[model samples]
Target: MSDTFDPDHLRAELLPLSTLQAPSEEAQAYQRFYGLNALGPNGATSSRIGRVEVGGYDIVTQLWVPDQPVGTLVLMHGFYDHVGLYRHVIDWALGLGLAVIACDLPGHG
Candidate 1:
């Protein structure tokens, strides 16, 4: 890959993540900048980050699950926030054996 934004390739890789998989190299770069992997809070049974088109708008989404999750939690961020900013929250929910799904606000992060 080059130093460019390759949406097609990313979609090809990300679209298959039903429950989530390892991050691609390009994704790792962005993840670092976004603190997606901060503090080693990666105890999820599976996790995924992807984009979805809803009402013709692109939104970044993340899902994290723990083993034997008792329930699910849909997290939301404030204005100008992204999913990466809530890693701790994700970790907390996962620690409580809850699956978490969150998305970035439009045109932010």
Candidate 2:
């Protein structure tokens, strides 16, 4: 991890925006700071990103699978939290050979 990791930058990227349009600049900053793409490489595993429609809204989802999985671990972010904030936990889980599945809650993050 780089010493320049900024929590503010990550928080800005994770903020819920009123507009539906994507902010390319913030997204780029997030990629650079976190060393992870929206749905690309993550440490030793490549993650899969998708969305599931429940009720009348779309919920973002992410899955990280190791080469040889021993079990599955579900990660749920707390209030005002996002998946990016749980990278360390995810890394730890991956190291333990546990596949991780995380999702953005209904209206949080």
Candidate 3:
């Protein structure tokens, strides 16, 4: 929130990401029930990740363009959260042809 904080540089540095580890039995079962793939690494994917200028500030975002985007889905993370944490969600949205706009709000830890 302070002018001293450079969002662009921070985004370029340590973008948040969940470490891909062995899934629990429960998680695997849930994935099977929903016809979903394994989480994170083996899940839906997109590489168009970058920062976007919005409201005169650099809002870090990842663009997952679908074959035919039905519409846009803007995902705003809660306090102390970053957009990268929702990579799987964004991947799914891209697969469904929905453009995503995920933003890391100010003061995210």
Clashing pairs in 3: 80-109
Could you tell me how far off, in angstroms, the CA of residue 51 lies in candidate 1 after the best superposition?
A: 1.5
Q: Could you tell me the TM-score of candidate 3?
A: 0.49
* Candidate with the greatest TM-score versus the true structure: 1
Candidate with the larger lDDT of 1 and 3: 1
Q: What do the candidate models score in CA lDDT, each in turn?
A: 0.67, 0.63, 0.50
- For 1-109, candidate 2 gives per-residue lDDT tens digits of 3324444453444433323444345544544455444331345665554555568766666677887778999999899998878877887888888888887787754
Q: What is the lDDT of residue 84 in candidate 2?
A: 74
User: Which tens-of-lDDT digit does each residue in 1-109 have in candidate 1?
Assistant: 3434454565456643354567777665655565554422344456677777778866667776776889998998898776767877877777788888887767665
> In model 2, where do residues sit more than 4 Å from their true spots?
1-42
Error of 3 at 89 (Å): 1.5
The TM-score between candidate 2 and the true structure equals 0.62
In candidate 3, stretches whose alpha carbon ends up further than 4 angstroms from where it belongs are: 1-47, 54-56
Candidate 3: C-alpha RMSD after superposition: 11.6
Cα distance off (Å), candidate 1, residue 85: 1.6
